[model samples]
Each structure stands twice: as structure tokens, then as C-alpha cells.
Target: MVSRILNATVIGIISGIVLGAVLKVIEEQTTKKVYTLLLNIDFIPILNSIQFGEMGEFLFHLLFSIILSFIYMSWTEKSSPNSALAYFVKASIVTFPTILLYFPLSFLALKEVPAINDIQSIMFWTFGHFMYVIALSVLVYLQQKKPRS
Candidate 1:
């Protein structure tokens, strides 16, 4: 049990780092910004505003990945190799709570810290969450396909 938890944590952190790097690259290329959720509030500024040096970025990714991993595992407790579609189902299930919780929280946070005083900014941020959901789905699918030894 301890080993499983430890493995899950390590995997989560590593996955988070990878996902964060990819997200960072996407943000840089598209000039999009990312925020961190704080106290059920999105407190961080646009990704571009942050110094987000290499170390800071890595830590951000690592922490998020760890959290995501645990969420994934918990949501898919009964999933197994025999259930090929289980990953997609679990991914969809996971997305619901995130969208419900993060959307309003993010909207309020952004409203409080108005990066751009326009409707487009709100739309873009909301769209970004959709993209994140897709990414999470892909990540969960990939992880499920990994061979266990």
C-alpha cells in the first residue's frame, strides 16, 4: 500500500512536470497565460507576467502533476486493463467537477484582477479550461495504457 501510494506520487509529479512543460510551451507560443488556483481562487497572473524562471516552472508543474495524479487515481478506482474504455469514462467524470468548480472560481478571480477588461478575455480563459480538459483526458488515457509490471 505504501509502495503504491509512493509510486502514484512519483508518477504524478513526473507527469505534472511533463504536462506543465508542454503547457508552458503552448502558452509561450500562443502568448496565452496560465493561473494557479489558490484557496478556491485563481490568484496568479497571466503566464507572461510571471518571471516563471526554469526552476519555478518546474516546481509548478511538479506540484500540479502530483495533485492531478491523485485525482485521477481516486476517480478511476475500479478501472483496470480489461476495461479499455474505463479511462475515457473516468476522464469525462473528472472533467465535470473541474469545470463546475474551476469555472466560477476562475471567473471571479479574473474579474477581481481584470487582466483585460473585455468579454474576449473571459472567453479565452474559459476556452483555455476546455483545452486543459482535453489535455487531462489524453494524459489519463496514456497513463492507463501503460503496462504494469
Candidate 2:
């Protein structure tokens, strides 16, 4: 159990960093604010009032990634999909709901996040999440691989 949790944490951190960096770069290049959106907590009531800098907000996002890793690990442990496509599909299934978070996050955020109905931002968010799904799938696949002599 301890090992499983540790593995999950490591995988989560790696994948989370990848996703965050990708979104950050995209936002920087295009000035779309997807990265800011990714770390937004303005809907969380009291927590929203405090100013969490980029690193702090990123750590907060990583916390969620770790939780998601734990959940994904447990789920994969049950069925253990064998193929790349299966892994991709399974990860997509798990990650699909999170892609919808853009709407609510935009709607409730007090900060300068993208508008709720902004199609370009929505597409960017979706693309980022899909990249996240790919990272999750690939990492999970690699983790499950057995070493041989």
C-alpha cells in the first residue's frame, strides 16, 4: 500500500508538471490564460481571497493531480488494461469529466480568467486536458511494465 501510494505520487507529479508546463507555454505564446485557469481557485470561497503565487497555485494543482493519480492507480489495478489504446481509452474515460471544469471555473472565478463561453479558451482547455490524458496514460503504462533480464 505504501509503495503504491508512493508510485502514484511520483507519477502524478511528473504528469502534472508536464501538463502544467505545456499549458503555461501555450498561454504564454498565445496570451490565452489557460495556465492561469488551470490554477484558479477563486470558486473556493475563503480560499479564493488569499493570493497564491504561481508556485503556490501550481502546488495546489499538483495536489489534485496526486489525488487523481491515486484514483487512477487503484482503478487500473482492478482491470489492468494491456494495450496502449486500452490505456488511452481508460484514461480518457476517467479524465473526460475534468475537461468540463472550464465552464464552472470560468463562471465562478473572480480573477481574470477566460469567459465561460469563450470558444477559443474552451478549445485550449480541452486540448490541454487531452494532453494530460495522454501523459497519464503513457505514465501509467510505463509504470505497469515489468522489468526483465
Candidate 3:
């Protein structure tokens, strides 16, 4: 159980970092602000009281990713996914709803972020999440493939 938690945590950190960096680069190059959207915490009440800057906001995002990884790994343990493709599909199924979060997050954010209805930003956000799931799937697949010592 401790090993599983550690593995999930590592997967979460890596996947979260990949998603954050990808969106950040996209926002920097295209000015879509999807990265800003990813890091927004203004809707969370008390957490919105102060600015956490990029790194802090990123840590907040990592928290969610880690929690999500825990849940996903737990589910995978039950489901016993046998292939990389199966892991990818399960990860996608688990995270599909997050793509829609762009709408609510944009609406609720007090800080500057992409508009709720911005089509381009929505596309970028969806793409970033797809990448995130891919990262999670690949990492989880690799971890599961390892022989237990």
C-alpha cells in the first residue's frame, strides 16, 4: 500500500508538471491564457484571499493531480487494466469531465483567465488535459509493468 501510494504520487507529480509546462508554453506562445486557467484558484473561497504566485498556484494544481492519481490508481487496481491502451482509455474516461471544467473555472475565476466561451482556449485546455492523461497512462503503465522486488 505504501509503495502504491508512492508510485501514484510520483505519477501525479510528473503528469501535473507535464501538463502545467505544456499549457504554460502554449499560453506564452499563443496568448490563450489556458495555463492561467489551469492555475486559477479564485473559486476556492479562502484560498483566493491571497496570491500564491505561479509556483504556489502550481502546487495547488499538483495537489489535485496527486489526489486524482490516487483515485485513478486505486480504480486501476480494482479493474486490473492489462495493456497500455487500456490504461490510456481508463485515464481518459476518468479525466474527461475535467475538460469541461474550463467552463466553470473561467466563470468563477476572479483573476485573469480565459473566458468561459473562448473556443480557442477551450481547445487548448482540452488538448492539455489529453496530454496529462497520456502522461498518467504512460507512467502508470510503466510502473505496473515493473516486477515487484
Candidate 4:
């Protein structure tokens, strides 16, 4: 049990950092407006502010990633399934609730981003979330597959 928690925490921190970099690069390379609005819930003023700015957004995701990993790992104790498809299923469990929470929470933390915005923006944002799931699920699956030390 302790092993699982420890492994999960490690994986979560790694996942957070990797996903943060990926998301940042994607946002930078492609349309900044989409991922910026989707991933960041910082109020417009803070987001635009000279201090903390983008770092604030990255840190928020990293912190949540660790917290979410603890929650998700706790649920994966019994009869471990270890397939790619299974990973997707587990990740979906994490992803859906995250999106649901994000929509409402965005308003509280930042301005309410219109969910009914452009189709491309929504699509890319959703893809970014899936990318997050992919990173998490892969990390979890890798840890699970390793021989218990």
C-alpha cells in the first residue's frame, strides 16, 4: 500500500511536469488562445499581470496533478488491470470528472470562459486534456507493471 502511494506520487509529479511542458509547447507552437483559456483558470488580471504570469498557470496544473494522482492511485489497489485499453478507461475516469470540475471552477478562479466558444478551440483543448490522461495512464501503468521491489 505504501509502495503504491509512493509510486503514484512519484509518477504524478513526473506526469505533472511532463504534461506541463507539453501543454506549454503546444500552446506556444499552435494557437495560444485555446490552451491558455482552457488550462488556465487564473483571473485575467493575474494572468496578464507582470508577476508570476505563465508560471502561475503551470504551477496550478502541477499541484492539481499531484493531488489527483493521489486520489486516482488510491482507487487502483485491487486486481490490477494492465492493458493500454484499460489505461484509457482509468484515465477517462479521471478526465471526465476533471473537465466537469474545471468548467465551473474556472469561473470561480478566473473569468467565466464561454464554453460555447469556437469549435476548434474546444477540440484542441479537449485533446490537451486527453494528452494529460495519456501521460497519467502511461505512468500509472508503467509503475504497476514493474516488479515489486
* Local distance difference test scores for all models: 0.53, 0.87, 0.91, 0.66
Which whole-number lDDT from 0 to 100 does residue 88 have in model 2? 86
lDDT at residue 115 of model 1 (Cα atoms): 43
| Model 2 stretches astray by more than 4 angstroms | none
Off by over 4 Å in 1: 35-61, 75-81, 99-102, 108-149
Write the residue-wise lDDT of candidate 4 on 1-149 in tens digits.
77766877787778777666665666677654544554555565545454556667667776788788877666654646667678768777876776565445444544434354455545655666777788888888777677876
**Which pairs clash (backbone N, Cα, C closer than 3 Å) in model 4?**
none
Going through the candidates in the order shown, the clash numbers are 1, 0, 0, 0
Q: Write the per-residue lDDT of candidate 1 for residues 1-149, one digit (tens) a residue.
A: 67546755776665555445544554556554433421222245576466665677567546665676667766665555245456656655654554354445556664243244445434554455455555555555566567777
User: Compared to the true structure, candidate 1 yields what TM-score?
Assistant: 0.53
TM-score of each: 0.53, 0.94, 0.96, 0.73
Per-residue C-alpha lDDT of model 3 across residues 1-149, encoded as one tens digit per residue? 88888988999999999999999999999999999999988789788898789899999899899998888888888898989999999999888888988999999888789888889998999999999999999998888888878
By TM-score, how accurate is candidate 2?
0.94
For each candidate in turn, give its C-alpha RMSD to the true structure in angstroms: 6.0, 1.5, 0.9, 3.8
Best by lDDT: 3
State which candidate, 2 or 4, has the greater TM-score: 2
Q: Looking at candidate 4, what is the lDDT of residue 112? A: 38
